[model samples]
Target: MKILKFISVLAILVILVFSFWIYRSLNAPYSHNKNNQYIQIPQGSSPGQILVKLTSEGIISSPIPLKIYLKITGTGKEMQAGEYLFNSPITPLEVLSELKSGKLRTVKLTIPEGFTRFDIAKRITGQFPQNQAAGEDAVLKLTEDISLIKDIAPQAKNLEGYMYPNTYNFPRAVTTQAIIKQMVEEFKKVWKPEYADRASELKLKPHQIITIASLVETESRLDEERPVIASVIYNRLKKGMPLGIDQTAVYIAKMENRWDGVINKSDLESNSPYNTRKIIGLPPGPISSVSESSIKAALYPATTNYIYYVLNVDKEDKSHRFYSTAAEFERGKAAYQTWLKKERK
Candidate 1:
C-alpha cells in the first residue's frame, strides 16, 4: 500500500511539472537581436517549414512546443503565407495570432495627378530598390507594350497618359508589369463609355482626346480653366496654327533626355514633333498623365473664339487671361514678361 501511494504521488508531480513547462513555453517571449524583423512566408510553405524558419531566425526558441501548441489549438493548418513583420520578444501565442490575422506587409505608393509614365517609373524605382536591376530604362521599355491599353486606346503608341494616377498599396515582391497593369486597369475604370461617343462627336480618336487632355492638364491647375485651355487647343487645331504650348517644349526635352526644368531657346525651336511651338497639330503623344477633369474638358470645350492666353499676374492665383486679338495678346504678353523679369530679379 505504501509503494502504491508513493508511485501515484510521483506520477502526479511529474504531470504538474510537465503542464507548467508547456504553459511557460507557450507564453514565454522569444529572444531576438533586432527589435523588428521582416519574414517572408513563401507560398505553399508548410507549418513545419514555418516553425523551422521562425526558430532559425531567433523569433522563437523551440519549434517543437510551438508546433505542438499550434496542432492542439487547430491553428497549424490555418497559417497564411506572405510578408510578416515581427517585433522582438513576441510570444508564441501572439505570433500565431498575427499569422492568423492574414495581414501582409504592403508599401503605399502615391502617384499624384499629372505624373507622366516616366515619372511613375522613377517613383516605382525609388520605392522598390530591390528592383534596381530593372532601372528607368528597363521600366520605360516595359511601358512600350501597349497591349494593356489596346482595348481602350487601339491607336495608343504606349501607355503615356493612360496610367491612372492614384494611391496604391502593393506587396513587397510585386512585379513591375503587374504594377503597370494595375494602373492601366484603374484608368479603364475611370474612363466611361460615354467618353467614346463624345470622342466621335469631336471627330477625334480616344488617343487624340487623351493627348489634348494631357496638354490641358499641364497648362492649368484650375479645374474651371481646363475647358478654356481645351478651347484654345481646339481653336489652334481648327485654324491649322501651331499650338505653341510651352509644356510641349518641356515634353520634347524629356523625350530627348535633356530636360533640365528650364526651357532653352533651342527647346522651343526644336524640330521634334512633340514641340508644339514648331508643330502645327497635336503632339505625337501625351506630354503627361491627365486628370478626369482634364479629360472632360477635352471632350466638351467651352464656346470661345479666344486663341491666346497669358498668365494673369494681377491675381494671386496662377490664372490666365484670354485674348482674341493679336494686339491684345501682345499687350498681355508684354505685361507677363515684365512680371517675369521682376520675379526673377
Candidate 2:
C-alpha cells in the first residue's frame, strides 16, 4: 500500500511539472529576434523541421517544449508553408496559430477606384517582381492579354475596366501575371449574373455598361451621386452628343506615355477614339477600373434629364451638381473654375 501511494504521488508531481512546462512554453512571451523579423518555411516542411528552424532563427528559445505540446495536442498537421513575419514578444502558441491560418506574410497593393490600367501597371511595376523585360511598359503589356476575362468581356480590347480595384496582399514572390490574374478574377466575382441581366434589360452590352460605370466612378466619389453621373452619361449618349468627360483625355495622355500630371490642350484635341470630347458615343472602352457601386449605377441610373455634371465647389464632399441644360452647366462650371483658381493660388 505504501509503494502504491508513493507511485500515485510521483505521478501527480510529474503531471504538475509537465503542465507547468507547457503553460510556460505556449503562453510566455518570447523575443530573441529583431522586431518584425521574417522567416520562410518551405513547402512540404515537417512540423519538427519548422519548429527547429524557428529555434535556429531565435524566434523561439527552444522547440522541444512546442514539439511535446504538439504531440499532446495533435495540432501541427495544418501548419502551412509561407513567408511569415514574426513580431517580437509573440507567444509560441500565437506563432502556431498564425501558421495554421495559412496566410503567408504578404505585401499589400492597393488599387484605388478610378485607377486606369496605366496606373495599375505603374504601381505593380514599382512594387512587384518583373521578368527580364522589367519595365512599366512591360507590365502594361501583360494587361493586353484579355484571355483571362474573355468569357464576360469577349470584345474587350484590353483589361482596362476589368481589373477590379481593391487592396490585395500577395506573396513576396508573386509574379505580375499572377497579380493581374487575381485582380481579374476578383472582377469576375463582383460582376454578378444579375448585373448582366440588368445590362441586357437596358439594351447595353456588358462592355458598354462597364465603360459607363468607369465614367461614373471617375465623375463622382459619392455613391448617391454615381447614379446621377451615370444618368448624365446615358442621357448624352441618347442625345447623340459627345460625352465630353475630361478623364478620357487623361487616359489618352496616359496611353501615349506622356501624362505629365497636366492635361494639355493637345490631349483635349486628340483624335483618339478614346477621346470622349471628340467621340460622339461612349469611349472605345472603359478608361478606368469600375467599382461595384459604379457598375450598379450604370445598370440602374436615376431617371432624369441630366446631361451634364460639374464639381460642386460649395459642397464639402466634392459632389457634382447635375444639369439638363448647357446654360445650367455653364453656371456650375464657372463656380468650379473659380474655386480651382483660388486653390491653385
Candidate 3:
C-alpha cells in the first residue's frame, strides 16, 4: 500500500509540472516587428471567432489560454468595437484591455472653402450654442464681451468676416470664446509683412484690403480670375464711375431686412454713403472679409485699358468678357442675353 501511494504522488506532481509548462508556452507574449497594423474586430464577433482571427494573424498563439487569462483578469465583458492599431509585441490580455477602454481617435475638424462670416458664425454657434454659456448668442458672441477684440475690426460692425476659415482640432472641453480667439489669432498669424507692404503700395489700409478681398473671394471660385475683377474695380474708381456692384446694393438690402431677392432701381439709389452708386471710391468700409488671393488682387490689379466686362454666358463657363468700350460691352451683353434665354429654355 505504501509503494502504491508513493507512485501515485510522483505521477500527480509530474502532471502538474507539465500542465504549467503547456500554459506558459500557449500564452506567451506576441512579437510584431512589422509596421503598425490596424486590427478591426467586427461588431458582434464572438469570442471564438475573435480567437481564430487572432491566431491566424499571429496576434495570439491560442484562444483557450487567452480565455483562461481573461477569466482570471476580469476584463472579458468590457471589450469594445472600433479600428485599432497594434504598435508592438504585447500580450493578448493587454490588447483585449486596450480594446475594452475604447479610447477615441483624435482627428482634425476641417472647415470648407468659400464660407462667409455668417456661415462661420453659424458653424461655431452650432458647435457651442447659447445654452452652453449662460444665454449668450453663440461661441462668437462670447468674443464681443471681450473688450480687447471689440475694436479689432473697427470698420466691421460685427465679428462677421474676422472668423478665418480653416481646419481646427477642437477638443470636447474647449470653451466658447477661446475658439473665437483661436481663429482671430490664426488670421493674424497668416497676415504677413509682405501683405502690409502690398497694401501700402495699393494705397489701401489693411482693413480696406480685407473688405475688397472678401468681395473678390465671394465673386469667383477661380483663383486666377481675382486679379481681373480687381482691375475692373480699380478702372471704375479711376474713371469716377459708379462701381455698379449689385452685391453692394444687395448688402444694404440685407442689412435693412427689405431684400426682395434682387436689387431694384430704388435699392441702388438708397441714401447710405455705403451705396457705391451714390458715393464712389470703395464703400465706407469693406463689404466683407477678403481672402489671400483677393488681397493679392487688390494689391496687383491687371494692366488693361478695358473699362467694362460682362459674363461670357455664350460659353459654358461663367467667366466675363472684358471690353474697352461701351459698344463692345453692349455686344458682349447681347451675347450674354442670348445665352441666358437659351439656358432658361
Per-model TM-score, in order, reads: 0.86, 0.85, 0.63
Predicted structure 1: lDDT: 0.88
Please provide, for model 1 over 1-345, each residue's C-alpha lDDT reduced to its tens digit, 9 standing for 90 to 100: 999999999999998998788889889888687456678788899999999988887788888878878777877878888777887778887888877766678889898878887788889989977668778888888888999988878888889999888899998778888988898888888899999999999899999999999999999999999999999999989999999999888877877888888999999889988988877899888888888999999999999998999999999888999999899999999999999999999
**Of the pair 1 and 3, which is ahead by TM-score?**
1
Clashes of each: 0, 0, 3
| Shift of residue 1 alpha carbon in model 1, Å | 13
Residue range 1-345, candidate 2, lDDT tens digits: 999999999999999998998898889999765566668888999999999989888888889888988998898898898878887888999889878877677789999999999999888877776443588888888999989878888899999999999999998789888999999999999999998999899998999999999999988899988888888888898999998999888999999889999889999999999998988998889999989999999999999999888887887998888888989989988998999999999
Tens-digit lDDT track of model 3 for 134-199 = 533454355444343344455555554455667887644456566667777676776777887888
Give the TM-score comparing model 1 with the true structure, all chains together: 0.86
Number of clashes found in candidate 3: 3
lDDT winner among the candidates? 2
Q: What are the Cα lDDT values of the candidates? A: 0.88, 0.89, 0.67
Alpha carbon lDDT at 344, candidate 1:
96
Better of 1 and 3 by lDDT: 1
Instruction: Specify the poorest-scoring 10-residue window by lDDT in model 2.
Output: 125-134
In terms of TM-score, the best-performing candidate is 1
Quickly count the clashes in candidate 1.
0
